[model samples]
Target: MAATEQPISYAQDIKPLFREGDRESMSAAFDLWSYDDVVQNSDAILGKLRDGTMPCDGAWPEEQVDLFQRWVDAGMPA
Candidate 1:
């Protein structure tokens, strides 16, 4: 049997990436709380991730980053 394919969900996958309290802090510049917010700002998101400018810390683990890229490549689905 073939492996099941799971669609990435914003509420399930993406939203968890951001810290709860900090979500509002970045809202002034970028809103990452919803599907539209991520889709609209995907370029900045991916670019920042690639350049290691996001997370205000450092690069996320390779697996997590890959997951994010996969979500992006999958059209930033909700």
Candidate 2:
């Protein structure tokens, strides 16, 4: 639940959970996450998910939420 506990690779675990490779619904952590303030705020992104403001297309599953949370809880590893 802490940043230090994050897994090393974002592309490996986190990317796969979302539409990263789908192209149609693909979401790059970098695109959603900017180098500025937003990149560091995982909750902001998750809040969108939790409040049904994400994808702008559809909602992610709870399991996907957990995966995203884990990645966020893990410090949004790059």
TM accuracy, model 1: 0.80
Error of 2 at 51 (Å): 1.6
lDDT tens digits, residue span 12-68, model 2: 665554454333443444344232333465667789777766767777878677777
lDDT, candidate 1, 1-78, per-residue tens: 123577876778878987755467678877777678778888888787777777776777776776788788887778
Residue 28's C-alpha lDDT in candidate 1?
Answer: 83
Which one wins on TM-score? 1
TM-score to native of every candidate shown = 0.80, 0.57
lDDT per model, in order? 0.75, 0.59
| Clash count, one per candidate | 0, 0
Off by over 4 Å in 1: 1-4
